[model samples]
Target: MNREFIEKLENNPVIAAVKDDKGLEKALKTECEIIFILYGDICNISDIVERIKSAGKVAMVHMDLIAGLGSGKDVAVDYIKNTVKADGIITTKGSLIERANQLGMYTVLRYFVIDSMALVNIEKQDRHGIAQPDVIEILPGIVQPKIIKKINSISKVPVIAGGLISDREDVMNALNNGVLAVSSTNEAVWEL
Candidate 1:
């Protein structure tokens, strides 16, 4: 993991999550130090990453959302590392996290807490050494402070609250609950 990047997250917990070219441009103009790319195609991803880096911001790609990247984790990971040269990668697959780690790239494993079963699965995954991401991103961040607290207590890695973060209050709530950072697609929240 990049200690500097981690420190940056600590200093400014709001991460700009860009979903399109316009969003990317908007994110670069923000005070955010990190940007999570939730949109890109194989043809344009490298350019997008370059643009983010040129702006002196850390770029983290949501690997599963990229188009034309194919389904093979190894191939996508390798491309993101060697080609895009992104600061990190976000994914829901543990295997992808493991692969990205091996490649010397930062990894964020996204988990959707839709129900109680999902919470149990998170613990099970951690126990089995499958959830070994540098950071774990829990979705619907505002609605589950208790669950977030539970995960934070047991998780070895830092937790990032993401999804459904609509405003400054939501960001603050997540941070108050012990999340290392909050990823939001809402540009308005970027200012917070």
Candidate 2:
């Protein structure tokens, strides 16, 4: 994890997770310092990233959602860095996170916490001495406080609460749970 990147996120906890053109436009007009580009393809992705950069915000492309990223391969990481020019990458695949890190790109590892077994992922990522991602984003953002505590206790990586983060109450709930930040596609939440 890059301390500088974490510092940036700490300064502004609301990250704009844009999945469409309207969302992107709204995000660029907000106070958000980080914009998670959740929509785009191999062709127009570069332009989308450029617009985010032009707005002077950190642009993080979610690899899996990008149509042309080829299932989150290392080469896809390369394309994002060398061609798309995004500030960071967000993915559920640890391998992609590792690859992005190797390229010196900020990486966010996303996880869907559906059950108590989410703790297994912490050990799994750490098993082979593999480095943890710069940040870990847990889906269904309204995860239980105890679950948040458990993850924080197990890993030092800053946690970002994403998915289903629709309003201020949800945002507050996540932040109060010890997450470093909250990412939401809801434009109103971005205002908060």
Candidate 3:
């Protein structure tokens, strides 16, 4: 993990998480504040890192989909440190956050809140075991203003709204509710 890159994202509010090479180009053209490259898509981590540096944008690796880490905590931590060179990590597990802190990497914990029950459970769990991350990516499934506020209330870390967000209104709704920024695979929202 690169401390400098993590600092860059913390400083910049908006970021674009691009899915492919095309999306990378689009994100660059859009002048997104930061760019996240999925670790699975990377055949050459060094090349990608160089491109990101050359473009003057913060680059992070998305390791949530990695085979081992997707299943459990131990493998997740191993892959997080060994498989990618990123400013930080994007994961859901509380254990991973703790491990990232140990590795001296910034953590971006993602929570998929499908309903109010899940939100409540997350808040409860957050209180006891998890160390606060540098950022939390909240995927509320449906972009509800109330849900956004609910997440904001419990989390001290900066909130980033993601998943199923389709337009500027949804983005505005998220931001209005206290999310520091938003992320999407959609190019339209990527421009925002």
* Predicted structure 1, TM vs. truth: 0.95
Candidate 1 clashes between residue pairs 3 or more apart in a chain or in different chains: none
Candidate 2, residues 1-192, lDDT tens digits: the string is 798889998999999999999889999999999999999999999999999999899999999999978665789999999999998999988889888998989889888999767778865775564757899899989988888888888776888899999988899988998999999999999998
Q: Which stretches of candidate 3 lie over 4 Å from their true place?
A: 1-11, 39-43, 67-83
Tens digits of per-residue lDDT for model 1 on 1-192?
557667888987999999988988899999999999999899999999999999999989999999986595688899899988998899988888888888888889888988887778778878888638888888887866788799888777788998999997898889998999999999999998
Model 2 misses residue 52 by how many Å? 0.3
Q: Show the colliding residue pairs in model 2.
A: none
Best by lDDT: 2
Best of the two (2, 3) by lDDT? 2
**How many angstroms is residue 187 displaced in model 3 relative to the true structure, after the best TM-score fit?**
1.4
* Candidate 3 clash pair list: none
Per-prediction TM-score = 0.95, 0.96, 0.80
TM-score of candidate 3 versus the correct structure, residues matched by position: 0.80
Candidate 1 worst ten-residue window by lDDT: 1-10
**Tens-place lDDT digits, model 3, residues 1-192:** 345544565466467877767777788777676776665443565466557757776666666654344664655555546665565667777777777778777677788877677677667756875656677888852467777777778866667877877788887787777777777777888766
